[model samples]
Each structure stands twice: as C-alpha cells, then as structure tokens.
Target: MEYVPVWIAIGLVIGVVGKLAMPGRDPGGFIVTILLGIAGALLAGFACRAADIGGDGGLAIHGAAAVGAAVLLILYRLVMWSRTR
Candidate 1:
C-alpha cells in the first residue's frame, strides 16, 4: 500500500521514542523495535476508533500511540524477564 512506507517511518520514530522512555538493553534488535512501534500504532488506532475518536492527525492520537508503544515495551520486558528467570 502507498501508506506502508509512511507507517514504517512513523513506527521507527515511535519505536525510538519508546526505547528512549524506557532505557535499558533491548532483548531484541531493530526489527523487533520497529514491530513494537507499528503494533503500538495499530493498537492505539483501534482503541481510538472504538472510542469514537477519529484520527485527525492530532496530538491526541500520537500521544495514545506513544503510550501504547511504551506499554508494549513494558510487556516485552516482562516476558523476556520471565523467560530468563
């Protein structure tokens, strides 16, 4: 799709922001980071849609995505931590 590249770029930026917010050694590499970001956006988008919040390219949607990314990052850390325990 035409939006794939734009999504990836946004994802990468969101992913980097998530990583920065939760500073530590990443268990996975770049691809995982990118996936996390993309997934975060998707999660937020869906939730917003369900809540009747349209994505009007505003700060609210972006902020939700960031929070989603941070949440996923935390979950990822917990999973990896449990596996190593």
Candidate 2:
C-alpha cells in the first residue's frame, strides 16, 4: 500500500519530466502520464532482469530506465503519427 503512493508520485514526476524533455505537440493528460510512467517502470524492471544487473549496483540504472522509457514513448508517438497520416 505504501508503495502505491510512492509509485504514483514517481509516475507523475516522470511523466511531467518526460513531457518537458521531448518538446513540441505531444497529446496527453493525467492518464497518459500515469501509463507512461508505468511503462517506464516495467521497462526498467525488464531490462534489469534481462541484463542481470539489478542485483548488483550499477551507476546507470535509473538513467538507463528513463532513457529507455523515453525512447519507447517517442517511438510510440511516431508510429501513431504515421498511422494517422
């Protein structure tokens, strides 16, 4: 239960930051932000598990996760845009 709020807050922050990080005409709201954040967390965990690096200390864990998520989101947007055309 305690983790829920923590995750929510983290999600909001990540979403807002993500929005700011990639400028210009992204369409989304609170729900979209939450989804993006969740996706980010999931991607992070998956990468960690696949690489077998989460068990040990890594200087780039958080950075890698954020970057990975941002990349995914960007790709998503691009695909959506292309499809709409």
Candidate 3:
C-alpha cells in the first residue's frame, strides 16, 4: 500500500548509489537497476531476519541493504566478465 512508493524511492536511491559505487558498463538499464536495488534490500532484510540481527528498522539495516545492492552489482559484473572470456 503506502509503503510501495517508499520502497520504490529507496530502490531508486540504492540503485543510483550502486551504479556510482561500481562505475563502468553493465547489463540492463534503469528498470534493472531498480529491480536490483529492491532485490538487494529484500535479501538484506531476509538475512537480518534469519540472523536475528536487528529489528525492522535501523541504520544497520539500511547500510546492509546498500552494501547488499553493491555486492549484487559487483557479482553481476564479475559473472558477465567471466562469461565474455
């Protein structure tokens, strides 16, 4: 519901940051970026829940999400690079 827009905004921010953090050519475009961001956040959330690390909201969660997004982007690049060789 109301959280949808908030999630999208978070996703956009995470996506842009992920791109800037790992500058260079990659796959897909804006849509893919958004999806990556959202997926990363979701992944972080699930990990945190499984680990019982933190509550539903906190700086740690947000930081983890950002890191997760960057990691995903980096992995994607690595895979693509390997595939080309």
Tell me the TM-score of each prediction against the true structure. 0.67, 0.60, 0.69
Sorting all predicted structures by lDDT, with the top scorer first, yields 1, 3, 2
Off by over 4 Å in 1: 1-8, 18-27, 54-57
Write model 1 residue lDDT over 14-82, tens digit each, in one string.
Answer: 787766766666678666876888786667655765686744545675566567766776688789778
Q: What's the residue-level lDDT of 34 in candidate 1?
A: 65
For candidate 2, give the lDDT: 0.59
lDDT of 2 by residue, 4-79 (tens): 3443444556767766666555466445755787677557645665687645434455555556566666676677
RMSD of each: 3.3, 3.9, 3.0
Please provide the root mean square deviation of candidate 1 (C-alpha atoms, Å).
3.3
Which ranking of candidates, highest TM-score first? 3, 1, 2
Give the per-residue lDDT of model 3 (tens digit) for 1-85.
3333444456568887776776666666666776888777667656765686656556676666667766776677688778877
TM-score of decoy 2: 0.60
Alpha-carbon local distance difference test for all models: 0.67, 0.59, 0.66
Clashing residue pairs in candidate 2 (N, C-alpha, C atoms within 3 angstroms): none
Q: lDDT for model 1, on a 0 to 1 scale?
A: 0.67
